[model samples]
Target: MYLNLTPKQMVRLNLALAVLFSGVGVYGLQSDSLPISPYTCFTLAIACVVQAYYSTEKFVAKAALSNTITATDTSLTVKQVYYQCEKEEIVELSRISQLKVADNYLAVILDGNGQGYDFQIKGKAEAIIERLNEVLPKALLKNSPIKQV
Candidate 1:
């Protein structure tokens, strides 16, 4: 269930977080006592909490689920749960699709509606693509207009 991120991706994420948190902290310090006519202190407090979440690596996603895949009918259903690095909440996705792999991520295009969402799989993007392609039905691509690779 634990999907580990590649060291490169993790480093990039960490660097981004560092810059964002630093900016937030500096802004807070410089404008801490500034009075607001419309916004309340509660809003600023909430922003601080969000900034804190990004400052720590504890929020990075670690696991995802592969719930279902049906080969006979060329239909697949997969549910992937991920941690939203800053929000500290698990994002749950129930997707039924033909999988597509890209340079840095994988996209699951839904068959029924012709809609899809993308996931940035940490380290095993290529391997996951190969595995999904092997397991999913070939007929799933017959009617799909989107190109797969």
Candidate 2:
């Protein structure tokens, strides 16, 4: 199951912020005396718009299951899609060598390969962290305690 981790008002707030930033950028570009760069404001506006897209929680595609495995296998491949903006890959928890949890982020390391995926936790971190705790291994959090939000 997919869960939305962003606050309900975040979408509106981000869009509003995008509008404000874009307007600022435009105004800044019009005047040569402004201390702030118009390009910087435009960049911030684009960033806000991207965050708004992420906060919207829209599903783009579902994961596909294939590549048959033997019956003796301990873990199987399953598709997990977070959001359209984030990566959607075939990652099994059993393959994870390390897990990092925090108020604003979650990181999973795979099989000591020095490669990992990091997810940014937004809005209500507690709820998302709790859900992750449910689906993920308890041992992953034994060392790292999630800070209260």
Candidate 3:
């Protein structure tokens, strides 16, 4: 089975904010009437660009996850494509620690190192949670539930 995930809305919002900040910076550099210093505006713009870059990375990861998550009878393969590079991690079913469901995200926790891979849950969150619950072993399910925020 293959499961797909969607990116969060905040990613687009961050990109939009980045563009807006850059425009403001350019405008500040051109206009004299504005009280804000060009240096300040430029700094803000750079910060926004950094924010947008990180958000873009998150968006790319989400997009990659959307196409990944291939589950076979014995193992689950997670493929991530970022910056034109493709990475794959294959885990045996027995090595899975737990499937955690929160209000907006789902996390797959690996057994030994307790590492987690989180995927944003868009529409039909309940159905996806239920499906995960049904597929994974009861022993692997986390006893402590995540609080929905």
Candidate 4:
């Protein structure tokens, strides 16, 4: 099962890039014919290659869940692999007092002993939250039953 990014996203990205760098590529191509310093053309070509590499990586991640979660008896392991441009964080499911799926991210409420970090699953936030609810053991998810203290 693979989750794909919407076609509209791809189309919009392509259109934006076309508008952004088409002139640069065309200028480089035209200048290469003029027989001046070849460095400008080389630089432009390199820039295009780098841009393609970056976009390809982003598209791959946007197309699927780059991270994985494995539920265990005592705790849940959330191995979140973020894109190179993105940041990654480690989270222990035992510390999570609550889990909420918001519009675009997962809000993992942590316990006081930990730093109380909220783990955000980037693309498939809802799916990840559902999977966690399904696969996580009852003990890890059990709270104190709301005792009045």
Candidate 5:
């Protein structure tokens, strides 16, 4: 079974916030009456730029993941994008430990380890959960924790 997921709207919101913060920082630096010191304004501007860069990077990464998950009876392959580059991770089904469904995200645990990768669900979390239920191993899903939104 193949599953494709897209980035949620929060990505865009973060981008917008980044821009707003940057503008405020720049304006603060230019306005003498603003009461904020030049150093403070500069620091704020740098922070905002850093946030914007990360937000844009996150958006790109999520966009690149569109329809990149491919799962077979034996293994699952996930293609992830980072800074315009593509990376693939392949895992054997036998290595999967469990799946966790939270309010608006899903996590795939591997090798009976507590660590895992998380994906944010775009819409209707229940639908995604149901589809996953059909495609994933019954044992993995049986004792999984699903949080209510």
Candidate 6:
């Protein structure tokens, strides 16, 4: 089974804000009717640009990579953000000892190795849990309990 997770996205809104502020800045540069100085408008424009850039970067680096979870009979592959980049961890079905679901994140632990990978669930823990139950074996979750938030 494959699942595409929904993440809170605001790039459009941020870009829109940047454009609005940029228009105000350009107008301020061309006209002297407003009481505010042109420097203020320029500052606001620069600030907006920076905000848009960071928001876009964050969405791409963090949420974009964490966009899907794929499970097969052999393994479970999860897309997760690692450091400043995206990493895919493919754990064997038998290796996954536990699947922990939180309100906003899911953690998968590998047996013996104790290695863990966490992915953002974004308030869809229930859906993820359901999907896991369908693909994963019952024995793996015998010790794991679903916690309702």
Q: TM-scores of the models, in the given order?
A: 0.34, 0.49, 0.46, 0.47, 0.47, 0.53
User: Residue by residue across 42-69, what tens digits does model 4's lDDT show?
Assistant: 5555565454544464545543443445
Candidate 3 worst ten-residue window by lDDT: 2-11
Our tally of clashes for model 5 stands at 0
Q: Which lDDT value does model 3 have at 109?
A: 73
Q: Give the Å error, residue 39, model 3.
A: 5.6
Instruction: Give each model's whole-structure lDDT.
Output: 0.47, 0.57, 0.59, 0.52, 0.59, 0.64
**Per-residue lDDT of model 3, residues 88-122, tens digit only:** 77777776666666654566677647696776543
What is the per-residue lDDT of model 5 for residues 46-144, given as tens digits with 9 covering 90 to 100?
665554554464554564323445567877666654445566667777767776665445667877778867765433567556656556567645655
Worst 10 residues of 6 by lDDT: 2-11
- Clash number for model 2? 0
Clashing pairs in 5: none
Q: Give the count of colliding residue pairs in each prediction.
A: 0, 0, 0, 0, 0, 0
**Residue 99 displacement in candidate 3 (angstroms):** 1.8
Q: Select the stronger candidate by TM-score from 1 and 2.
A: 2
RMSD for all candidates, in order, please. 9.4, 8.2, 7.9, 8.5, 7.7, 7.7
The digit string of per-residue lDDT tens for model 2 on 114-141 reads 5877655442455555655555445545
Off by over 4 Å in 4: 1-16, 24-63, 85-92, 112-115, 142-149
Q: Is candidate 1 or candidate 2 better by lDDT?
A: 2
The lDDT, on a scale of 0 to 1, for candidate 1 is: 0.47
Question: What lDDT score is found at residue 114 in candidate 4?
Answer: 30
| Candidate 6 lDDT over residue span 1-149, tens digit each | 73342222345555666677777777888888878876776777677665555456554455532354667778887776544556677888777766678656778777746577877644467777776776665665676544444
lDDT of predicted model 4:
0.52
Off by over 4 Å in 5: 1-24, 35-68, 81-83, 103-105, 111-128, 137-149
